[model samples]
Target: MRINVLQHTPNEGPGTIKRWAQQNHHDLYIYHPYQFGVLPTAEETDFLVVLGGPMSPNDSFAWIMKERQLIQTLMEQGKPIFGTCYGAQQIAKTLGYAVTKAPYKEVGWAPVYLQSTVIPGVPPQLMALHWHEEMFEIPREAERLFSSDLVKNQGFILNGNILGLQFHFEPEAEDIREIVINDAEYARHHNALQQSPEEILQMAIPPENRNVMFHLLDFITK
Candidate 1:
């Protein structure tokens, strides 16, 4: 399988998802939409994985609109999309939902409760990792699949083909540290930051989070 990844920034690269792709023998072709301004045709990939970034969904940057169009087009073509944080907000805003400042930013690892009462064959509690200030308003016709105590709309299912995640289930422990370190502005705004690597790691991701992502992958592929 070939996965086309839309990377929005230099620091924020696809993390755990890359592991999944490699483990499953899926080739990943990444396009930095900010630099290239053009994404290769999605017809060549088995899945579309949109990585997270620090930018706001409403940013007037050229790539913002471009990626939106790309995601919209891919969805119309029935392409399976798995989006994280900013990528998820892009999907929501593109699909007519609002992405605004979350009531309170969730900067560290926060466990997200599954909204699906009876997960086909999985547990209901998942340790969802997060690092963002903006949250999407759950879209109409979209089922809220996961929620955190702070953010009720943590992840949503669209057409059972597209999955949008507000948290960072794909974070590579280091990514969590880098994001908090670099985004002191975000940290100050929410006063929701961890001061040290130890503090951040304490919010340690749940072991099953990766398994949950795999389940999502299995669902999307099926």
Candidate 2:
């Protein structure tokens, strides 16, 4: 199956999803709308994977609006979408969901409790790497999927074709390290707690999470 990847920045690639696509030999096309100011062509795709970035979904930048338009078009075609963090916010904004800040910021690995209907191969509950200060309100006609102790509404789904995840389930060892490198800044902005690489490694489930990632790819492409 062919997948179109909309990347927002140089640092945030598909991470674990990239490995899955490569190993499975699926055709993967990538776009950097943030850097190139290019928008997605009006075309149908089997699956659309929107990666995360540091930008807000409500940013007035031209490229940001163009990216949102692309996502809106993909939804119009009934194509499946899998979005992470900022990507999730894009899906929410396109579907008339509210992207707002919560009482507290969520960073690092927090426990996300899946509410039964989210049984798409991921466990009922798992610790997910969250690196966002913002949260999205569930969109209209979307199934509010998961919740966490910290974040009441963690994710939402739209007609089985679109899934928006507030948490990062695709973090690699190096990804963890990068966050640590900027931990001081994150701590200052949100008054967040610091987590070491060792602390994050303790909760790392790379092997198990890979299985879930493949399941998601199959789901979107199907």
Candidate 3:
């Protein structure tokens, strides 16, 4: 399968998703619209994975708007699509939902409570990395999958093929370090839900996190 990844930043690459693709013997291609202004066509992409970024989906950048249009097009064709953070917001916005500031700027490791068992093997409550100020509204027809203390709409699944996750389950230790270094300002924020850089880095990446990510990937593609 030709899996096309939409990467929005230099640091937020396809961490464990790449590992999953390698293990599953699927080809993975990453495109950076923010840097190159290029995206894969629906015909070239068998599956779509949109990575996280610091940018908001509400931004008026031409690339952002264009990416949303592509997401919409893929949805219309019943192609499998998965998105995280800003990518999730893009999916929601494309589906005519609003992407607005979350009640709190959730950063670092937080617990997300499962609202449904659409994706098997996920624990009832699991810790996931979060680094977004804006949140996507749960789409009209989508089933809400998870929620956190600070954010009500943490994840949603649409039509069994489209998944939107508001937190990071793919980032490894190095990926988290790079994210913290690139967005140091957000890491330093003192908040009830936010964690310090040291804390975020020190917390071990739970084995279940990657396992759950892999399960979701398989579930979406199946």
Candidate 4:
């Protein structure tokens, strides 16, 4: 399958998603709109994958608005899309939901429970990496899939094809380290809700997390 990826920043590239796509022999074409200032047309790909970034969907940046437009277009065309963190916010904004600052910044390994198990192979509760200060409201008709103590809407599925995730399920240990190094400002929020870099590194991602990611990918592409 031909997959188009929208990478918002240099450091926040597709981690586990890339590995899954390659192992499954799927083609991935990434467009770095932040670096190149251009977003590729999504018509050519069978699936669209939007990765996370530090920027919010509510930002006034011209490129961000354009990216939202692209997402709107893809959804109108009934294109299968998976959005993570900032990407998920973009999806929610496009669906007319409010994307605002979360009450508390959740940074580190956090546990999220599956509110709905419609997405096959996902366990009822699991720990995933978190690194964002913004969250989105669940759009109408979308099933709430994941929810954590800090964020009520960690993930949702709309029309059974579009998946929006507010946490970093695809990040590996190296990916977390790179994000910490690149976006060091997020680490300054010292509180019980937040975890230190060393602490986050010490926490291991469950093996089923990657498997769930792959299962979701296959389900979306099918």
Candidate 5:
């Protein structure tokens, strides 16, 4: 399968998604439409994975608009699509939902409660990495998958093939470090939900985090 990834920034790469692709022996391609202004067509992409970024879906950038168009095309074709963070917001916006400032700027490790047993083996509540100020509203006809105390719409699933998660599930240790270094101001913000760089880096990543991500990738594509 030709799995194409839409990466918005250098720091936010595919992380464990790339690993999953490699382990599963599927062809994976990562595209930076923000930098190169190029995106894969629906015909060329068997599956699409949109990674997180610092940008907002409300931004009037041409590339952001183009990315949304690609997402819409895939949705119309019933192609599987998965998005995280800003990517999730982009998907929601494309579906005619609002993407606005969240009640709180959730950063670092936080617990998200699973609203449904869509993904088996995943705990009802698990810690996931978050680094977004804006949140996507649950689109009509989409099932709410997860929620956090600070954000009600943490994740949504549509038509069993489209998934949008407002948190970072694919980032490994190095990816988290790069994110903290590139966006240091996020860690400096003192809040109950936010954590310092040291704390974010030092805390042990739950062993099930990677497995959960792998499960999600398999679930969306299968």
Candidate 6:
């Protein structure tokens, strides 16, 4: 399958997802739309994977709008799509949901209780990595799948073709360090839900989280 990756920033690439695609021998293409000001058409790839960034979907940037339009087109074509964090916010916005600031920023590792699992391979609960102050409402036609103690809408699935996750399941050890280091100032928020950069960097990534990620990839692509 030809999987197109839409990455928002240099620091926030596809991480382990890229490794999975490579190991699985699927053809993968990447677009840095924030830098290039261009995105791939739905016809160009079999599936779309949108990665996270520090930007908000509500921002009136040309690239952001273009990405949303691309998402809309992909949805109309019934292509499979997966989004994480900022990417998920874009999907929510495309589906007529509002993306707003949460009462607190959520950073570091936390448990996301599974509300329902239509995707088949995920577990009942996941200790996932989250690093966003923004939250999105569940889209009208989507099945709300996960919720966290801090965020009521942690994930959703639109039909069986689209999945949106507010947490990070694709980050490896170095990706975690880069994410924390690049967005260190966000960790300065005094909210109880926010974690210090040092704390974020030192936390041990649970093995089960990676297992969930692998299951999600297979569930989405296969």
Give TM per candidate: 0.89, 0.89, 0.97, 0.95, 0.97, 0.95
Query: Mind giving the per-residue lDDT tens digits that candidate 5 earns over 72-151?
Result: 99999999999999989999999999999898988889999999877677679889998888899999989899999989
List the global CA lDDT of all models.
Answer: 0.79, 0.76, 0.92, 0.86, 0.90, 0.86
For lDDT, the strongest prediction is 3
Best of the two (4, 5) by lDDT = 5
Give the residue spans of candidate 1 off by over 4 A. 117-119, 192-198
Model 6 deviation from native, Cα RMSD in Å: 1.3
For model 3, the stretches where C-alpha displacement exceeds 4 angstroms are none
Q: Which stretches of candidate 6 lie over 4 Å from their true place?
A: none
**Candidate 1 Cα deviation (angstroms), residue 65:** 1.1
Ranking by lDDT: 3, 5, 6, 4, 1, 2
In candidate 5, which residue ranges exceed 4 Å CA deviation? 190-192
Clash pairs, candidate 2, are none
- Model 6 lDDT per residue over 94-212, tens place: 98899999876888788898888587767788788888889889998998989999789999988787989998999989998888888888777764566688988888888777777
Clashes in predicted model 4: 0
Clashing pairs in 5: none
Over 1-222, each residue of candidate 1 has an lDDT whose tens digit, in order, gives 789999887767787788888888889889888887877675775788888887888999987887788788888898899889998999999898899998777776667888874337657777766778789988887888898888788988888889998987776677666665675455444445443435665576567777877878778766
Per-candidate clashes, comma-separated: 0, 0, 0, 0, 0, 0
lDDT of 2 by residue, 1-222 (tens): 677789876666787888888887887788898888765575746678888888898789988887778888878888888998899989898878789986577766777887746446668876678777888898878877788877777887777778888888776777666655645356345534355445654665546666776776666566
Compute the lDDT of residue 110 as modeled in candidate 2: 72
Per-residue error (Å), model 3, residue 125: 1.1
Give the clashing residue pairs of candidate 1, or none.
none
Per-residue lDDT, model 3, residue 42, is: 86
